[model samples]
Target: MTTHKKIRKAVFPVAGLGTRFLPATKAIPKELLPIVDRPLIQYAVEEAREAGIEQMIFVTGRGKTAIVEHFDMAYELEATMSARGKDMSALDATRATPGDIITVRQQVPLGLGHAIWCARAIVGDEPFAILLPDEMMIGTPGCMAQMVEAYNAVGGNLISVLEVPREEVSSYGVIDPGATLENFGGALTEVRGLVEKPPVAEAPSNKIISGRYILQPEVMRTLENQEKGAGGEIQLTDAMARMIGTQPFHAVTFAGDRYDCGSKVGFVEATLALALAREDMGAEVRAMAERLLRA
Candidate 1:
């Protein structure tokens, strides 16, 4: 097993305008939007932490300070809860050490690659992971953990991929795959090429790069000179594509459910799916679901 540098940090790009969310996001950052009770960003951070990521670097933008605050200590709320003798367990996930959670301002909505480049100083010269908060990954060991396990075996760039409808390939970074590594039981495959939101007709394959990634530090240098590709922005796909043949690049097909919380319908569907799986709400939610379906 090739031992790779530990993936101690994760970069979260939460600078989007959330225009699709409208008035709700007009005031609240979309990351702060809750799936059930906890915010979307919280889930993403927690997943990273569970995967042994020690540091969180959030690439923020204007009007995104709420995301930084969400991870900070709620002194007044904690005090009030303490006074009322209420369980503080629900707020436990929000607590972060003073410097453990760091934020860097992106200043512009350049693109995914630019947002990541903004955190170059923080990420430094080591391997790190990128987790998109809007994509809620639900699994027993977590999406990050699964990727980490695969990284331990291969020690290179590993991205999560899902087989999306061919027409939807234009909405995501499509992967052009080479031969599958049979040693990993066909779960891992060489990344032959990457296209950022390619035309459906020109797409290399139906598999889309899901939001999670284990990237190399060299990617920062590539993004520094990365020209805007698809969508007239510095797409991360272009940067990753440049690194494909130079180093080990593979994709992991996620073996769990992933909810695209960025969309209105996806958000509602994620809520119901997760709500029904919760121990406290399962029975009631299931009954409610059945009733609603009948009506």
Candidate 2:
């Protein structure tokens, strides 16, 4: 029972209008927004790849063709790079080996659950993953990698979670703990229930769902007729909540930094943190930060 299931496919919901980002996002997808040198969606895809996911399914919208192309081969660009004998690392960031990707249009501004449902045909009967690109999780093993290990151990639905302050619980999907274990200097709790953005005073637990999830494909079927919840749009949390008691669900307390890059402030923070982590930019960032502090 401890054998790890090879979860080979992952669905990425990228259909949002990204209204939060305004005019800049008017043309460019917010998922294409760069954290440092890479787009937000690239970070999520890289995380899935690290977790052993072989196929990436992106649920996109009209303007999101760029997203599919971003992961696709740039033949002319590659030819130029090959001809120049250049490092080509820049081009490498945009290219995934052929046949590794699939893209479908969401066609409407629906909820997260709806976006996931759009990819149901390709996912089939296998257990799959859903990664929110806007939630950039940085770690040694990456967020999904850690969750995949936990999924192997638990053999059920798994959601990456982190303990947010009680006040912040209202801003996320909070988990109700049944039993807990400590590992890798972090806590893993057996989740009995989930409340989506519950009131601060009524939250069952302070642990909030971090973006990474290894969900049973049955959930996609459940979403087939799922009614709208929480803001009149299909809510993935609501669908996941219904799977309680039927499936073994747990909250994996991950060892990482979770950044909500969909917002203006969080995006800037990710940019600075990632830039400071890079060997090339670290020194410049340090000096400029110091100069800014002095000024």
Candidate 3:
């Protein structure tokens, strides 16, 4: 039996050029784009923190300096806000301890596998999390926290899965399930296999892998020698696929709504949904949304 250790580190692969968002992303990293007020990456970081993750390892690329600055303390800005009697509590989540955050440059846009491989040094031997900031999962308890709870009971490697329509299975890494375990009032399926973007007819199951993952350290070693799979780029799914039988692998069906904020439509949807959920602006936002629909 494998002994499960506490997860203390998380990797955020923000190296993507964000070509989907084009000009806006050409200057600002997509992870830094605001969903409502907080940037996309902050949500991922907050989720990790809520899961008791102490260290955040960001695999960044060129022109992504803003992300580093965003998490750093802004002495002048904070001083100005304090002098003006502005509430500084809201910025607390963005601040990190001196050594809590680590940034490594991917140098090249190889793939998610390579990006994660880049952080292997920092992650060392612990089981770490990988959170794609673009995938915004909203729920009472954050997705990573939920996964951590499940991880505590059965720990090897776990990825969050969601039941998408059968027709939509081709767009994600479809899982071949083995056995199902009850967790957090949801189901955790033992992942027998993973197929990246399989055609609908060939899909093993409609349970698609979401962006949250609690991967063991051995995955990094697999990724190191991983060849390009699916998309001519090193695929994380491919690397993870290699680690299946070696350890306990499971997929937790996330009980929440996930927004693919990497796309324009998803970004707008997340912004509107988050705005409508806010106590200070819910009524006004809902009223405007209703009026806009009628118009």
Candidate 4:
């Protein structure tokens, strides 16, 4: 029997050149783009922290240094804010302890699997998580935290999934479910297999893989020999598919709203959705949205 080790580290694959956002992403990473006030990556980091993850391994690329600096203490800025009698509490969550964060560069633009493989040294031999910064999941207990609780009960490999429209299944990695679990708020499903970006007719099921993953370290080893799948680049889904029956793989259906911030429309929707949920801005934003819609 495989003894489940506690998941303490999470990998953030942020090496992608955000071609979708072009000029804006040319200088600033898409992960650092503000969803309202907080950057997209900050939400992922906070979710990981909430899930009992102690270490953060960022697989970064060129011009992504801003992400590193974002998590570090800005003494001068804090002092200035303090002198101005401004509240510094908002910045508290962004701070991290020294050495808690680790970064590795993926010099070549390989793929998602390759980006995660770059963090192999830091991940070592333990169960870890992979959170995509672009997938902004808004939930009460948090998505990753919910997955961590499920992982504690049944361990092996876990990935967050959502039921998408049948026609839209081709845009994601569709899952083949084995058995339905009775607990965890009825959001858990046993993963039988995974097909990456399959055609609508050939898709195994409507349940598509979302951004959050609690993967075993063994998948990294599998990725080392993984060949390119769909787009002539190493795909993470390909490696995970190989571990299907060998491990206790499951998919947790997320209970929150997910925003694919990788796309322009999705990013704007997430920003507005989050803004509308804030107590300070909800009513005003709602009224403004109604006026704009009416115009």
Candidate 5:
């Protein structure tokens, strides 16, 4: 039996050029864009922390320095807040211990697979989780925590999945499932392969691969010489598909709803959803929303 090591590190691939949001994303890293008030990246980091992860590895690229600084200690800012006698507790969630945040330059505009590969040295031989900062996973226990629970039971590569309309499968990377892993009641499915955005007729399953993943270190070896797939870029799905069957790969269905903050529509949806959920803002926001709808 293969031993599954404890997952202590998480990789955040923030190297992508946010072309979709245009001028808004031009100067600001899309990961730093706010959903309500908190940035999208903070939500991802907090989720990883909830999963008991110690090391936070960020694969970043050009013009993304603000991301690293966001998680750092702002001595001057904190001191000013203290002098002003203002509550400074909120800054705690925004800061990380000096060594906890490790940023690696991706250098190139490669695909997700290449971006993940940049963190292999930092991830080393341990099993690590991957959370796309733009993909806001919202839930009580958080998606990463739920994925960690399922990983403990199965002990292999695991990716989060959720059902979508069959017709909508064309817009997502769907999973080719074999059977439901017993004991989890149907929450865990044995993933035979992955199909990236297939047409409704050819799509094998309606279960689309969401943003979170817990992968073993051996995947790094496969990615070392991985060939470019769709869009002539190293696709993470291709590498994962090759490892399926050879390793115990399963699709874990998390209870959280994933919000894609990478798109304009998703950004607005997430902002409204999260804003309305906030205790301080909920009532007023809901009233304003009702007024707007009525108007």
Candidate 6:
């Protein structure tokens, strides 16, 4: 049996401008926007915790201080709630477990790789998972938890993969699988190569990359002197591609519903799906949705 290697740290890149949401995101980080009641970023952090990730490192930018503060203890609010006999559970919900969360400011408007590079000192030397708040996957065991399990078994860099429409290939990173690993517990296949947002005609397969990733530390070394690529951004894909032949890289076909919460339509869909799952609101929400469909 492969020895279990626990992933102790996770990197979240939350510094994006969120230009898709436009006016609403003008003052708020899109990650802070709620799906139903809970903020979108909270789901990503919770997923990390569920996967045994002890430290959550966030790469943030200016005006993103609220993202850090939201995960920190709100002592005054907790105190007031206690004085008013309010449910402590509600107050406790705001706090991340002690020593579990930390924030690093990405002062420059670099790309995802650069944002992750800012947290290098804190991440130290170990394989780390990277979760993007914009891509929220709803699942029974949670997306990152599943990826962690696969990573533990295979002991290499793993990325969440799923099939997308052929025309949509350019919207995401595509995977090229050389062979299928036998007896792998879940829907996972050893990845032969990766192509970044390739045109539909050139895409090797329909499998597009998802947001969850378990990457080896060596990739950071690649990113150390990585030059800008594709759209003039320091693409993380470029760095990972450099690690291809050196390290074992694979893709896990995650079983779940992924919401592109970065987009307006996806945000609405997530809100509706989560809201309709709540016992108190489920019936009414279902009825309203049915009525709207009928009309």
* True-structure Cα RMSD, model 6: 1.6
RMSD of each: 1.4, 1.5, 1.4, 1.4, 1.3, 1.6
Highest lDDT: which candidate?
A: 4
lDDT of 5 by residue, 96-194 (tens): 887799999999877999999999999998999999887788997999999998998889899999998777999999999989977887899999889
Off by over 4 Å in 2: 2-4, 182-186
Per-model TM-score, in order, reads 0.96, 0.95, 0.97, 0.97, 0.97, 0.95
What's model 6's overall lDDT? 0.87
> Judged by TM-score relative to the true structure, which candidate is superior, 1 or 4?
4
Q: Which residue pairs collide, candidate 6? A: none
- Candidate 1, residues 1-295, lDDT tens digits: the string is 5688999999999999899999899989999999999999999999999999999999888899988888788889999999999999998889898787999998978899999999999899999999999889998789899899889988889999999889899988889998898987877888999887889999999989889999999999999999987678998888998999899999998888999998999999999999999999999999998999999
**Candidate 1: C-alpha RMSD after superposition:** 1.4
The true-versus-predicted C-alpha distance at residue 77 of model 3, in Å, is 0.9
Q: Which residue pairs does candidate 2 place in steric collision?
A: none
lDDT of 6 at 265: 90
- Which window of ten consecutive residues has the lowest lDDT sum in model 6? 89-98
What is the Cα-based lDDT of residue 272 in candidate 4? 96
What is the alpha-carbon lDDT of model 1 when measured against the actual structure? 0.92
Of 4 and 6, which scores higher on lDDT? Answer: 4
Per-residue lDDT of candidate 6, residues 1-295 (tens digit): 8774579999999988889988878999988999878899899988888888889998998888889888888889888988999888744556877778888998987798888888888887888999999999989799999888788788889899988889999888999887777777648887878898888899999898888889878778788899998878888888888888788888988898999897899899999999998998999999999999999
- lDDT, residue 36, candidate 3: 84
Candidate 6: stretches off by over 4 Å: none
- Quantify how close model 5 is to the true structure by its C-alpha RMSD in Å: 1.3
For residues 20-81, write the lDDT of model 2, one tens digit per residue: 99998999999998887888999999899999999999998988899988888888988888
Model 1, position 278: C-alpha lDDT score: 93
Estimate, for each residue in 1-295, the C-alpha lDDT of model 4 and write its tens digit. 4457999999999988899999899899889999889999999999999889999999999999999999999999999999999999899989999887999999998899999999999999999999999989989789999999889989989999989989999888899988888866668899999988889999989998989999999999999999987789999999998999898999999989999999999999999999999999999999999999999
